[model samples]
Target: MGHVFGAFTVLVCALFGVVITANGITVDVNDEVSIKSAARIVADGLMNYYHGNESGRIPGVFDGGYYWWESGAAWGSMLDYWFFTGDDTYVEVAKEGMLFQVGTDWDYMPKNQTLSLGNDDQGFWGITAMMAAERNFTNPSSDEPQWLALAQAVFNSIALVWDSQYCSGGVRWQKFVFNNGYDYKNSISNGVLFQLGARLQRYTKNETYGYWAEKVWDWESTIGLIDNTTSYVYDGGSIETNCQVLNKIQWTYNMAVYMAGAAYMYNYTESDTWKTRLDNLINTLDVFLYGNTNVLYEPACEPSASCNVDQQSFKAYISRWMGATIQLAPYTYNTLFPMLTTSALAAIRTCNGGLDGVTCGYTWLTGTYDGKYGLGEQMAALEVLQSQLIPYTVAPYTNDTGGTSIGNPNAGTGVLGSQTSSATSQTKDKAGAWIITCVLSAIAILTSIWMAMDGKGEAKKLQEWIRVESNYA
Candidate 1:
């Protein structure tokens, strides 16, 4: 049976000739069997990056350049894989990894992750929890933290820190004051918050989540981070500059997160405002789609080969969110399905890398492997490939519509206590010492500021340096 189906897939691909790659995986856009076959191959390559299932390794994590937050994102992709294909292979590992990281507070703010945790980082994990709930994946035991509660916890925790002191109101890139880019208010942080809130609203029929989602949209638009005219979402800006100067780097993930948020809002309310926002966002996505080919590309860093560890896996979010948007707002299928098909075809063609012959690459427009491989590249291809199966899958579930995850409206309302791990406790102790050091350093810097101000040229140069340093995306 396997040989017969494989041969038939080859014949269909040859006859349709929609897309072909050097790798063993090939897909005929019109054939579900072909897409799933190719997706399974790509999924194998994606999982090759995972070592979290091994003894002594952290659950839900990938080794090498992958950060803590990306592990969460990867599991989210795996959940989509399970939802789309009915595959149970990865479910146990993903569930263990996620449950292990929910922290003492039942939120995703594990003490070890706190040193580098950004609102965006925690938000990614929350998004994954929401996906699990929507997919009706295996539920936790009665005492274990539920998926809906975890999502709500993340939302509540992040929502408390919405800084009104700068950028009017937007979540900072980093959750802690000590982290780099703490002064930056980036789109991904706020976008994730918005997307999470939107999902929560749909799931629980909670208007408070809906209200916060609207507030984020209004602030993003008013601050011009989301361009009202072109509908292009910029990377972010510094609160130090009062967010007056934008970084202006157009990242695919930023747009994709917001697109999902707007789609969910529209789906829940059926209002024209959300409907219009969704339409404009989709219409403007052509910017990331390389010219007439419509294959997704990272505009800021792909051409220059400067994409950082985080930027590399950005397409995974885009592909995943695009699938979510299609399900949320079914009207979008006509406009987005062709783009997804074209992009998926191009994406898999770049998977002919590594000894396994299915390792993927970052740039899909090249139509060949770029020799650059990571969790991001493999995930990007896997998402686009498996997302082709979304149309045949059931729509995401809601509380009233068969969702079973339990909720705790106050899950994230209080301070996060330390977990019982000795390693986590030691890390918190180190963090406390660092905070004191930062205070002393701030005092010393303030003393130098007066001396520098005495010389006009020196003060002007200092201002320029600060502006440039804080402008990072």
Candidate 2:
């Protein structure tokens, strides 16, 4: 695969006596595009009609059928964008996609969402709806059946897959015990449940959620699915291996889903164990997943063609949940944001014209365009770019506990003001006005210098030149 590299100069700009550093300033000229607009372009390309249906669910391949997991991942990231930035333009589209996936019981089942056969896959849609659940959605679906209830039913389905037969307890990859992948118990399925449990625990103060949270964490921790030594989450253990050996593929989302789970656990329990575990997992990511230029990447398939359709969307959660963890645990801001910011800027630079004609790709490290366009690629890119919206996103949520949230004091409004572009003619007009103001300010300074020189005639000439320049502007 060919690679594309853009020269980036990371800047730590101090505005009004406070230092702002979440997704630091990148000198990549392409960075000037509107983040929201890029997200919309990505959606337009990827969320087209799939399987001859007119739903907003993002397709897996270009003009192709829907993959339950990928579409869920895309919706999750899109809602994250709306939540993270408080921009609701994507809400209607996200609602349609989400609504299409939920079954009659509101569970994400194959009866509704296609190929939603695996427990982990169903868990994805449930977890995606939780984002809506946490917020007060004014839409009809928000109250039609209650988003949290939907999330709970999905949780119920995922919990049904737990088998003590494997390492005392772990979720089967497939729902049925007789299925081919049923013997496989992976991190994502179980980890998402742990995440849901923790979040529900925090939101509802229900000990039942806490119970499940601790149960899954205990099982994963005890079985070494999360390496006790390294804290990196291994893929899964199969019945073929007697659930004794771990896959240890180390996908970015496997680690991140756990990071997010631990973060919610921290918010709910404030337990040092969860904090320590989350910290250790982040350290593991730094060592393993942090790649060229200290940006995020999958070790097995970057700068190469090995990453399959499913593997392409892994980092979206890393960008989403890692940012979420920061909201819940402010102590991690300095350590995590710089790396995340690099990846975010890399994503923005990958867009065709920053905001215009954006088609995001799966690979972030290449020096040239990889030319792969699909729902997975767009969602992965959307995740990183939307992550830049975290500073704004975290502020409102942090207020949940109290007015003062755990983050940079001025981060929310400051960084958000700097990063957001409206993607309209109004923005171009503002740029033009700023340039005119700058030129006028320069002219005024020059006029003052000439007056100090005791040359009235020369000052007049300077005034005429300034007037001519303004007319040209």
Candidate 3:
């Protein structure tokens, strides 16, 4: 494949007082040079856990307890890194990892990941693909899947599975019925779809994508996942209860995705409603920001020391999407800069762990290393620090602009299954269908029980494995 390289100046500045070496990273949000220097060190810390480029390792996989899904997110952060800092150091590996994981169908639903794959999981890769297209990242070869097409394929595939039968309308957490969280209708899944649709609409100038974006926003509002008046987004609800029993635990990424989506809508339509929604969503983020400090934190799990591996990384998306929001909604800079810079400063303080003394910890409010480090910690710190370049960079590209990625509107058409018709059902067939449903329900029940007993524990096992792998590496 042909590659494009951007000239990057990775400078190590020892400017007196302008840059302070906090632990192992430079601390100076005021100087772009200092910010990029800090970001480079943090990015290096992040890559320390990545073994994807090794001969025996999977091209896109990370070395730690990171899952197939978060690997995509990690690469997305690298894309952001390259975009923000003009550092092409990781783009070749990023492209390889991203391309290697877009399964034969080109939708990111690689068969190897089918067991644990959730709608949100596939959505993360699609989000990354969309970012590549928007950022005008180095394109793939003629035979490879184009970034826009990959994202569109994911959108179409997930759109086919949008379950109107449950809770009136919402996507399930897991794509397959056999998966553990299939009965849950989560905001992250729907929010991702909304964000993807909004971004595609802006890039393609397509109303169909915009329509889906609107539909998701409306459904989330009607189902009480999003309180439109306050713009407060809750986690999700169980479909078995018809989505009534809500999990009110709010995470930063949930709000970030939807806010970025709304900002895209506002930018595309230049309408008052979307602008108000975007502003309200931004205002509602006070829930994640620490009291008057403007520093970000995970309220649901950070304070209690209970955040799992996945939850530990949620704040990165907040910084990631907020930076994107500034491009689409330029007026938000003054309101958002303080929040981002404040959080970045606090987050860098946690980068005093690991042998290199720059590996970041999870909790930023601690003002010192909390001894935690992984893909989550490093990626979180990289994003918060590199996002300082938001004001210094150009806005993302669209087809009308300089975006070079080729897209297929009907990308996932081949994967869309035909809807079963009730009119053609026979009495015997109906009986058989009922029996099948009953058996599947029993299996689902058993799966739920097993998950309750052991599913989440798999994360711990994976984490331990990753620790061992990193140690050996």
Candidate 4:
């Protein structure tokens, strides 16, 4: 009887264990599919931007023409696509788009240049161009020198305008003070310079680039242009506060550029401080920017403001930054995956909201509903999905046994089970033991019943003995 009971207990435990393992595996498969779907959405967007013939000249409702900042963001999308796909086709498209910005002359003179060279605009455009140029330079083709020269010319031209006073702390939007010098010391301006400096350092292997990047980073932090308080950084300084104000609120791009630059700087210098900074930034973004909500509101922004309260802008930025961060720090796969996955899913929701070619609420000044599907928004969504999906696409996870089992228990797998597998396994084991114990108790109760049927005195003795043994055990 004892042998039979022991065998039954072991069998039940093992079966229950297998059931728990199977449930976990089912959950993992679901999560992986969700992640893959999210990645696909992002990839589709990227493909659309590269191949879609959407005209770039649509007038924004608030702003009169296509924003140069938006154009720069488009470049970011292309870069993301290239990084994730490792497909030269996306890279080629990115180069062409950047060169188009440089125009036919490729000179810094701004001849026939219709695009705004406002300090902030120039910084954004130049930095993106520099990045494209650096990327092109690494694998020089016929167009490499042209791209480099064009990028350098624009960068130097912007640098030439710096007087170390008005544009002193960093780059201002323009020479004129707009909205109480709010235009001065813009976060985007500093962010771009930070990007440029980091890229330049990598391409040139010169410490000067690092120096400039660090200087801009310091300025951004000290001036509070980037939100110092939030785990995620804000868009730019408030026009009124000279202190960082979250007016247009928290844009994903703002944090993305900061993280991308920080990650790059860490890579270049192998600095733990930068790595920590990058990790914290990513962590904050993942927590705040995700969930079922389609809109991301800047907690600091006045709820009343029309221009600053746009949720699509927030979505746009989130996708942008996630893609960039992934590109910059591929090794931080665990950190980057959730961000990309969540942002991609959110972006899909944004698209479903009929945001296509609709002016985002953030473009308050541009009231006209310019065809809403701009390159920046589209590209951001695409880059995230494409980059994440590429790995799975190139090499499908063939070890996919339908049988439930623990996957590799590692913190960096970026899968949920990877983080909690051990704890979950121990919990299941404990739960199985309790179940087995309960079954044994049931058996004891039945045994006592049988004894009672045979004789009352004997039943009482058997019950007491069973209780004593069970309690001791």
Candidate 5:
């Protein structure tokens, strides 16, 4: 009987341990899947941007023919994928894309000159360059001097346009404006600066880069442009001072870039303060941009009662923002997945499986829906979905299979159809749930084992003491 009890106890303890381990593994797998989906989105987006010729330099005709500026963002996504997956293909894709961006050999650029480097453009390119420098510098193919030089040149141009006055440190819209000493402090411009500073710090190990990043944060924070009161970030600030900026004007693309840049900065600096700031920004933005209430509001044309302009609705803003969020998933915290999932689902519903059906006022009607429908919307959705799926230990149901529909007819009506049944959708939900369950179970089992082990040790000690007493008697 004692032996049986002991064996039972041992089994229970072992089972508990297994549960704990399984739970942890599940959580990690979920995170891995999210990271993978992010990487694939980046790669596919970049490929589309470069090779997609349906309507000129426009990548895909989905999101209302909108220029998502995803190429630079994709680089960051691919870098994250390479880091987590340890896949050479992802690394190669990243290297090739970055090279293509700066390569003078492309048909887009003049043979004598490289791509036209703009501050916003270069800021993003700089991120890709820094990631490349960190990961692929050892490989001869990735050690392209021209790409590095172009990236640096872009940074130099951006730095030259930094205006010290006007609101701490902020970037100009263009180098020409900086050369002329015209510093206009737009939120987008500052967002670019914030990301660039963080990326530079990572690549060069320069404190100044981080310092500049913080400066941008400080400037935005003081103005209440970024969510100082909450944990998430908002969209651009008002064009006119005293014009009421909607707290819920959380555009997806800007928030993604901002969060990604902030997260990257936090990772490199290990700054708890930064992390706190990032958390606050993310929470606030998620509530505003993605919450069920649809808190999104467009910019008012003027503060007067007569100047009420609805501005762009939530759907329009999401078309742009979703792309950015997908690209930055790698650098941000794991909690981003839930928010991303919500957003993707919402987008799919709104567009109803047809890109044209989505009147996001941006990228639509320019490309084929392929089999999934809603080409541009699907592109962004796939990017997010792909990013989430790539790093799992278990295979995620990717919509890579041919017959899946992209949008939903009853989506905005609050009813999702079969597209919800697609492998991508099911796999994402499964992966997330599986990880959560596994991790929680594992933790519970581990705790049980520890308790059982303690009890067994106590029992053994008591037995030894009783035996000694009996022998002495």
Candidate 6:
């Protein structure tokens, strides 16, 4: 048959769109029910990965599970699931990850990963803890070593890596490792820092947090990692290249992470600069990562053999980051929500309902089942589905203009901050530029008119003088 049926499509034919089975749930793409079901499947799948495993660490399908960053990503994703749904089923997984990753001191110094724990690796754990701190736990606060304190410790540890050395002030990709990609300083390492700094500033109102946020933001501009006009963020550079060379690999996660960081900082400071940067980055992201159909396409990977294992999980971050961006910058609702919803629907449409749970495929564009079934792919799918269910809340406005910078979270409007688009913000920016242009043009025209009139008046005076001289003669 020319019409090859997906798992949902086949089930829809028999049941007329009504079923939520343990094997898998099938609902229309737009239905929020789909989001809930997907979240359950993803959480269950994560359990499957760790069920009998002693390490309690998720293995990376693309690389080694012991890779600290990927493990950190899994932890962060779990925490996100908790925050997104306010569910505690995910809390144990997240808690285990937080405690397991810490060194004997309960800090981020992993003994086995000391040589490998670069800025980005540690930053991922910090990101997870940051979320946990925000939730404060819906269940009893029984988790050891308080959430906020743990995040603060990791943030302090990461601060030690900042260098005035190469790339003009970013932590290297590797710390002690020599010539083993240690010379490079990538965006993920710094982008996570920017995110952590912005969020900390939002929560604590500490000036130092704002300072770190801006520092990383400025550093990217100085090093040309971000294109001034195009707003495209490139891969990092090696020391041998003098930080002058850049790898033009534009991964979806890089842009997503930076946009998310910018969005959070914008919300934290309400700075026009951060707002401008966030708008620019979002526009640029649309240019490179999203297709006209409103689905995400890894520009570098999709046209060929598909993304690698490292890249397999990249879209998950992008999806979750965009979800966070929508929460942080209500201005991005128009541009981001449609893309996210459409992409989620496309992603959900690809799930192959079988005994292994609703395993999703990697190719979102075709909605065709991606043959390579890995933990990364499932994690990626779960993230997008979870993103669809949660409605981001904006901090409630306070009458105290001079009050602390931290807005009151408990007093939220709960308005599902998902309407006004970033394009509106851009329009306002353009309006200001337009007003200046109009004023300048009017000034130039008036000056030209005055000059012409002056020239004519001088000529008439000369004529009058000539007439007077002739009469005298």
- Top lDDT prediction, candidate number: 1
Which 10 consecutive residues of model 4 have the lowest summed lDDT? 20-29
- Give model 6's TM-score versus the native structure: 0.74
Candidate 3 regions exceeding 4 Å error are 1-20, 415-473
As for candidate 2, its clashing pairs are: 3-367, 3-368, 4-366, 4-367, 4-368, 5-367
The C-alpha RMSD in Å for every predicted model, in order, reads 9.3, 25.0, 11.0, 28.8, 26.3, 20.0
TM-score (all chains, Cα) for each model:
0.85, 0.73, 0.84, 0.56, 0.50, 0.74
lDDT of the candidates, in the order given? 0.79, 0.60, 0.79, 0.45, 0.40, 0.61
Model 5: number of backbone collisions: 50
Tens digit per residue, CA lDDT, model 2, 1-473: 13333322211121111211212222321332355555555545455423324455232212454466767777677667666546677576567656656656556674644433777887887777667656544333322434555665666556544556436777767765334465567888898888877876565444555677788888888888888887878777765555687766677888888898888888768889889988898888764433346667777665456666777777777888878888888888898776677676666545452223455656666522356656677777677766655565443221244221111111111111121111222343244334433443454455346435743232111233234323322
Model 5, residue 14: C-alpha shift (Å): 32
lDDT tens per residue, model 3, 1-473: 00001000011121222344557677777878888878889888888888889988889988778888889899889999998888899989899989999998888999999989999999999999999999999999877888987887788777767766568887888887667677778999998899998998888776677888999999999999998678899888776578887777688999999999999999999999999999999998789976655778888777767777887788889999998898899999999877787777777767887788888888777665787778888888889888888878988888778887877665664623222211232332234334433443454565456646754344212233234323322
Model 4 lDDT per residue over 1-473, tens place = 33234234323432343211111111111244544444444445435434323466322111324445555655655554554445555554555555555534343223333433455555555665554544432323443334333443444444333333332256654423222232334566667667766765554444545776787777766666554676556444433344444333454556777787887787678788788777877766644431222223233331323222123344455555555555556677776665454333333333432333321112111112222444444554455445445344321111121111121111111112211221135453234324433543454466446534644232111233234323322
> What overall lDDT, based on C-alpha atoms, would model 6 receive against the true structure?
0.61
Q: Write the per-residue lDDT of candidate 6 for residues 1-473, one digit (tens) a residue.
A: 11223323433432443232323546444455566656776667655655323454333212345356766777667766766665677566556556666666455666767755677777777777666555554322333444444554565555545655445677666645432456677888888878877876665555455677788888888898888978998877665555797766788888888998888788877989989999998887665434345676677765564566667778789888888888888878888876776666656655664456476767665545656556566667777767776564333221122111111111111112221111223343233324333443454466456545654232111233234323322
Model 4 / residue 10 / CA error / Å: 40
Candidate number that wins on lDDT, 2 or 3: 3
- What value of lDDT does candidate 1 attain over all alpha carbons? 0.79
Best by TM-score: 1
Candidate 5 segments exceeding 4 Å error: 1-70, 74-97, 103-118, 134-143, 146-152, 178-183, 230-249, 293-334, 344-379, 390-473
Where model 2 places Cα greater than 4 Å from the true spot, the runs are 1-66, 112-116, 139-143, 288-292, 353-357, 395-473
**Model 4 local distance difference test score:** 0.45
lDDT of 1 by residue, 137-193 (tens): 898887788887788789877876776756677888888765767778999999999
Arrange candidates by lDDT, descending. Answer: 1, 3, 6, 2, 4, 5
